[model samples]
Target: MARWEPHARQRLADAALELFAERGYEETTVLDIARRAGLAKSTFFRHFQDKRGVLFAEDAPAGPLVAAIAAAPAQAGPLDAVEYGLDALGRDVFTADRRPFTLRRRAVIEAHPDLREREALKEAGLTAAMGRAIAGRGVPGLAARVTAELGGLALKAAYERWSDPAGTEDFGDIARQTLDEIRSAVAEVRG
Candidate 1:
């Protein structure tokens, strides 16, 4: 086995994204990504299962965001907890420097139907994960499920806005704004 190199996964992900953007996701091969990363094919396999896996690797933000939600103050409501989690993730994971790479990745995923399906599945998984996490905090099952679904919607909306080139707001701000919009919509429907 090749000696494990620190930041190897990130290096491969960066290279893969760059290649995916330049040559298109379908045109880029694993070997091309490995070569760009200055690593062997085996190294690429060790980090990611395949070319698509490189785009959907374990570095997903959902896990940490769920953990943050679980750690929110006990007095916080479900949406409040979700907002806290989004803020935590935005601060810790989606830093300003990562915006360009994120936009590029989104563009690649958007251009490909298969990748879009994968992205939807990933979002569903995140919703389920968030639901489970919220339920674990003693929230009722139905309420937790609804809250999680709403949070997922807010996250998607926020991410879409954040990925826009002309958008100036950060992820956390966008997420909060989206969540508020959701709340207002729900209230209007109830009234």
Candidate 2:
């Protein structure tokens, strides 16, 4: 067992991602990840429920983003609140320092069909959470659902842009731009 050290969760995550990249996600086991992290298997279990959990842990983004949405100013409309939430998540959770890890994780996820399905489920969960938050803010059910779905779509677009190696824009800027594009597309459909 490696010495009880700080950043154990981060170490486990880093090790998991590296191992998943090196050996493929399907072949990488929790024990392999723990060994690579210089930690015990128990330590891995302490931080994550399973190998997949290593990638989709509670600290990932969903909860924090939802909380941010819930905490947005009451006066803000549903879409504005979503933008605020995305901004908060971009600034606080998905900082530039995490970009490399995010890219690597995305690569691993995209390489696997099962992981892709799980990723879709995770995004759907986020959308549902956002819808609930918007509804809690006194928005009508259908409008809240639509706004949240649009926000989710914008988030996916922004994340793709942010993850692009050639892209230079900040996440918040990309998110806002994506939202604007979504709004414009909707306007075009309505006209």
Q: What lDDT tens digits, residue by residue, belong to model 1 across residues 39-88?
A: 88998898789998876774578878988999999999999999998997
Give the whole-model CA lDDT for all candidates, comma-separated.
Answer: 0.88, 0.87
Q: How good is model 1 by TM-score?
A: 0.88
Query: lDDT (0-100) at residue 68 of candidate 2?
Result: 84
For residues 1-191, write the lDDT of model 2, one tens digit per residue: 53757899988899999999888998989989988988889988888899999778735677678788888888988999999889987888778888887888899999999999999998999888889988988999899999989998988889988988887778898898898899899899886
> In model 2, which regions exceed 4 Å deviation?
58-60
Model 2: what TM-score?
0.92
Candidate 1, residue 143: Cα displacement in angstroms equals: 1.3
Which regions of candidate 1 are displaced past 4 Å?
A: 1-8
